[model samples]
Target chain A: MEKRTEPALSPLLLAMRGIVKTFGRSTAVDGIDLDVPERAFLTLLGPSGCGKTTVLRMIAGFETPDAGDMRLDNTPLADVPPERRPVNTVFQSYALFPHLTVNDNVAFSLKLRGGVVDIAARVRRALDAVHMADFGDRYPHQLSGGQQQRVAVARSIIAEPRLLLLDEPLSALDRKMRGHLQIELKALQRRLGIAFVYVTHDQEEAFALSDIVVVMNKGRIAQKADPQTIYSRPADSFVADFIGNSTLVEGRIRERHGDRATIATALGDVTAPAADGLAAGDAAMLVIRPELLSTRGEGVATFTGSVGNSVFQGERSMIEAEVAGVSLRFAAEAPLAAGTPVALWLDADRSFITRIAA
Target chain B: MTFRQRHLALPVAAAIVAGCLAPLAVLVAFSFYEVEDFELVPAFSFRAWGELAFSSTDWFLIGKAVLSGVATTVFTAILGYPVALALTRLAASGKGLAVIVLLTPLYTGEIVRIYAWRIVLGGEGLVNTLLQGVGLIDEPLKFLLFSPFTIALVLTYNNLPFMVLAIWVSAEMVDRRLIEAARDLGARPIDAFFRVIFPLTTPGLAAGSLTVFALSAGEMLTPSLLGGTSGSTAMALVDNLFGTAFDWPLASALALALLATLFLVASAMAGLLLRLKGARAVVGRV
Candidate 1:
């Protein structure tokens, strides 16, 4: 686990161009394009069966596309076999060989490549990087789920693969362990400086770990942007709703200005930060986050409604207010009881127009 | 005791075991006492044990039985593994039919199957006719029946289904995801099969081999039907001691000796299986 002295500024480590993969008659990964910047933590975020894992497998050479091309450093990946490719996968199951010790599992790729020089040393170094150096002598079953996952990560990263793909590597662990390891894995990726393409259905995990989040829906890229942009200004309704809990109220663009638009919804007219390509009269949804709405009336737009339900999360209380026959949810620090009448006010300057239907 | 209370069941089961071993215990007791006109005296003697131990005929017969058993078991395992693999890999719709087809020979009586093989290996059998039809031989082959080769073939055939069934069970228990994982980890098909599938199935292989060996060692009807005096096994020797010579003590001693030999073989194989289990643990670590 030699630390790269300087950031490796190589070109895009991998690319998927109009890739299509189908299982039975169902298209798992429809025509889509993806790019992994060198040394970047790119997470393919989607719900289950949305084909994020399929995309990672295609890049890893485990699954081939039926219609399009994949390139690793501008070279076609179609002809390369998995063993020959400079990519490795950390499977969702942590696919560690059940018959080999942790040291042996970590050393497997090195042994496969005929690296007989100080194999134990190499394994130790890799294990140490994941804080698992002492556990190398133990069997996989003897280790906890998180330990197995760390070993799986160590095993893959030991090869020093140019493109490391993780397919829901933490999905098997309990919530607390997954949370801890997500931070550690992000740190490890940064330290190793290898381009990572991670796939997960958990959007929170993806957003917390990735430098660039590619939000996918129904085998298509809803948006590919940095975590901040993906969270703050999701490109579409799917991206907004998938990335986080968002309230999409149907609306029509009433007016527009540079970087902002006024939308007239059934609830009322509200000013929303306009993304590029939005137009007047376009049917859209004002994507307001629950946290963005507040109890204090201090924004450009507001609505009055009766609170239907209120859930008190530790730091914030989420209140679902029935506005204009639609259940509009907003969050505030203060507790509000159900059936309580309140004004759902938004800091319209922060809200974005996420979706405008064709 | 109430009608619902069934403590009688345990006593009955214990009585059955004691009854079965009572004659064996008596035979063992008699083995240590000197014989006078087929009656055991109160005097303790080591003559029977010494004679049984030092007799070159006894040693040779034991050696022959062990060698034959080993050969037959090896033959069965070699032929059965492929069949087992094929059986376990069948589609769900076809698996039941395959099991039925393979178990048919097993359910058929052993003597009946031996008689069937006897006909097939006979001078005027279908095999000889087929060989003659091919013009590879001018006359029927006599060596096909009543030889050590025929004995081994019949024993292996008889034990084939058991070996195949054991291996099929192991194959069925193998985690399919491990194979896919190996492939995903960059192992080619052959490497995955040999490194993962083969080692994981070692327990079944050991079980199957031990079963085939023990059963072939004591096989009576198959050898008698297919092999005569030339390849007379230990069971036949034990039979002669009991029937022709009317030597019950010697027959019991021979039977005990055969049992001891099978026990030693089974222990050795069990040890091998344990080592394989340890290896499976190491595999898990990887």
Candidate 2:
């Protein structure tokens, strides 16, 4: 692989070095280094128990790291309590005060400051930002999940914190609402120019909203890069499997040629763009994305196989072909009949050969 | 007909009304009965009500009961909040143990607990001994026992568990995220408690207050047994009128007056508490 140049560095807003957190005997976050640039939308994406939320909590000062240093805006965050931190969170459950009206909830921080010149007007502006100005008189319980989420956003932003943290803010909503709010959140982040550290297990949500995506597994960062790099060239098998519907074929490197490597798999040897440092005889994985395989090609077929199962998804079909004791899943316009012989063409150039996950 | 969960409450409700209202009805009838030659007569009369209405002592005692109950409620509420909020931070197993420890004093009979308080608060008792040993005082505190302070102290101590338990349950029901959210929104720990934790748990505060008030207000034994001179209560007078004085009509009338006063006070307290925005948010939906 090419020696990738780091994206032009922006002034750092928050930086964490070797941050670690543990609960009892189990480690939740282990020695992770992270940086959030000013006005950057960074997302910690992982499965449950992957410590993504733990990282977010440490940033918000809710949970103190067991070890390591955290600095926000060049000041140490070790002794700064959550209340004193210039950071706010939009919790997954939208932890709005049930007793307070929408306007009061949004006006909370300003009121705590004792005297903000025009709290009501600022509250109006905050609620207006989330398009919830009319909900001022209503309590949290009176609002729907989506509306409550918008209020939570307004409540967090009214304080005008240097950074905003969102922990699965849209996970409770239905798909349509999730998509709608996803766009609104992205736009809001852009407009506010506040650094946002969002945590979610949903890969699509991460991709949709984040400028930098950090994929975590087992308390450690698996990959940190742009969405396109994370999607197209996953660091290892774990990132490849976690990010998309990519079929990983375990294999051994047959030869290494610069950025490309020939991986000897059960089906046969195939060369593809490979992760750096995979020498000959190293165990590797071939990442074959569903869209990279097709039934029609200009040249010869790569593998002849019989259809094992075909599932018809809306607007498309997922066909699994059994070839050489391996299942190759690919999406097609129409379902292929089971037991039918199918000739598949592998697009090797777009595929990735990467290291096996620990 | 199908039985719903609410249907189960009907029998209990009916039993409570019958058990409570029946005796009250008897008291009302007795208050109207005229006494003749040390024997109860069934003739209706307004003599007892007229006497009670004119008695300054009866009204003063009734007002004292209200003050005692309100004082105990306030003290318990102030003391209970810290304990209740602390209990919420305990682990699940620890919470169970804590609740058991909290209610252990109640397991002892009320009379037994009252006697125990005497041993602790008496001039030569545990508290005075400790204070003397620590050189905080040169002499055993005279006001430690058989005073208004003793009655108030014992009442607050005796009723604290109920208040703590009520508030603890409410504090536990308060989502932990709300407190965190408050802090995240720039609220200090104290701010979080006042704005989020306290408001949200007002329902519990209301419950605890009513319970502590009812339990402490009608109590005659604590004041009479521990309160020396200040121990005189309306309940004690009603008992005196019923037993030694042999004035059944007067006793019943005083008892009814005290009951009415307490009920009105309790209703007002419940109304004031439940009207708070926090309590309404919690209870209005349900």
Candidate 3:
């Protein structure tokens, strides 16, 4: 667990080009291209069965692609097995060997190599990285889920692999433990400086740790950008809806400026930020983030509707307002009673208009 | 313990003691009795035990029994492991049919199977005829039947299903993710097999070893019928002493000696296999 002295420069560590995999008649990963830079924490964010995990498995060499090529460290990964490749995966189940003690599990790869000088020292340092030094002698079943996950992470990183793939490693734990491990994982990634390819269905988890987030939908990457860009200006309507609980209204573009367009919808025309390929007549969807809608904010008046339902979360209350045969969800500081008529404000400058995904 | 389990334990315990331990106790007592006339008389004596201990022939036969058991156990383990692991990969219907097919040899009654083996392996048997007809050999092989080879081969074949079944059940319980994890942690397929698959299946291996060892070690019918010159066993000698020679004490002594020898061997095999860390992981340290 030697710490890297300098920050990782912009060198492409791995590249997957035109990777396609199909199970039976259904395509899992369809012609996807992904590039991971050195020391980059890239997360594939998608719902279940959206082929995000499939992409990670392909990179890990567990599932070979039906078509296309994968290269790691400038070497073709197609001919290399998982063991021979300088990559490892922390499985979703934390598939730790139950029979082996934590020390043995951490030292497994070193023993397999057969020429290590000091296995005990390496194992100790690896355990120390995950704060699991005292629990090396215990078996996997004796540890809790979170502790086992820490051991799994330690076991994967003991060999100092060039790239590490994690498949929902914290999904099995409680929220507090997951948050704790998320911070630890981000710090570990920064210190170790090894590129990580993580896959998770939780958007919040993906955004909390990833340097670059690749949002996927229906076996394709809908958007690959920084979390801020993905959240603010998604490539399509799918990416916006998938990343957050946003209200999408069907609209058609009326006119356009440099980065602004007027979308004619049922609630009337309003100016919003526009994505690429927007002409005067193209059909688009108005992306309204829930955070932008407020009851007491300085913004243009958007809609007047009756509140259908209101859920009071701890910080704010989420109110669903029905207007013009559409359900509009917006947040409020106080819980508005059902059937109460309310005026909602839309920060048109923050919202964007993107094409409707087929 | 739950009330149901506590109440059920007593009846099971009573049945095992009354059914099994009672017969063993009678044999132990009989081994210590001195033979009087043909009518009836019993007195404390160790003459039968002394003869059994001192006789070289008796020791040799006991050793042969142990060797036969160990050899068969080893053979069956090596052969059954692949079949059992393969069985785990099949679909449900295939597995059910395969299990039935595996147990087909046992269903054909021991005596009938022995006779059938005599026809298949005897001189001018099917194997010899086939080999000669194919011009592979000039004469029928002499050691095809009625030798130690025949005995070993038949004994291993007879007990193979049990080994396969035990190992198959154990291999089925192993999580598939562990193998992937092994590969992910820099292990080849062979390494995964040895590290994960083999270790996790030790409990099944122990169960199979005990069963095959016991069945092959004490086997009397197959060897007595198929093994010509090497057919003479301790069981046959004990039989002769009990019925033909009319010496109950010596028969009891020989029987008890054979039982003790097999018990010691089986216990050693179980202890060696089940003492593994993998076994302890599954069944807990015992």
Best lDDT goes to which candidate? 2
Please write out the lDDT profile of model 1 over residues A1-358, one tens digit for every residue: 4333433664666777899999989999999998788999999998898888888878777678999988777778898877778788898888777777888778877776674798888899999999999998887888999999999999888878898889899988889999899999989998999989999888889889988999888888888988999999989877877767788887888888888888888877888797787788988888888878776765544778888988888887777888789787787786687888888667788889857532
Residues A1-358 of candidate 2: C-alpha lDDT, one tens digit per residue: 3342445567788989999999999999999999999899999999999999999999999899999999888789999999899999999999999999999999999999986899999999999999999999998888999999999999999889999999999999999999999999999999999999999999999999999999999999999999999999999999999988888999999999999999999989999999988999999999999899999997889988999999999899999999999899899999989999999999999999999999
Lowest summed lDDT across 10 adjacent residues in model 3 chain A is found at A1-10
- DockQ score of the complex predicted as candidate 2: 0.76
**In candidate 1 chain A, where is summed lDDT lowest over 10 consecutive residues?**
A1-10
Best by TM-score: 2
lDDT of 1: 0.81
lDDT of 2 by residue, B92-179 (tens): 9999999899999989988998888889988889999999999999999999899999999999999999999999999999999999
Q: Deviation in angstroms for B75 in model 3?
A: 1.0
Cα displacement (Å) at residue B217, model 2: 0.7
Model 1 CAPRI rating: acceptable
Candidate with the larger lDDT of 1 and 3: 3
DockQ of each: 0.30, 0.76, 0.67
Segments in model 1 whose C-alpha atoms lie over 4 Å from true places: A1-10, A60-67, A73-81, A252-264, A271-283, A299-301, A356-358, B1-20, B30-51, B76-94, B119-147, B184-186, B228-230, B277-286
- What's the distance in Å from true for residue B166, model 3? 1.0
Give Cα-based local distance difference scores for all models: 0.81, 0.94, 0.90
Please tell me the TM-score of chain A for candidate 1: 0.94
Winner by DockQ: 2
> What are the per-model numbers of colliding residue pairs?
12, 0, 0
List TM-score per model, in order: 0.86, 0.97, 0.94
Interface RMSD of 2: 1.6
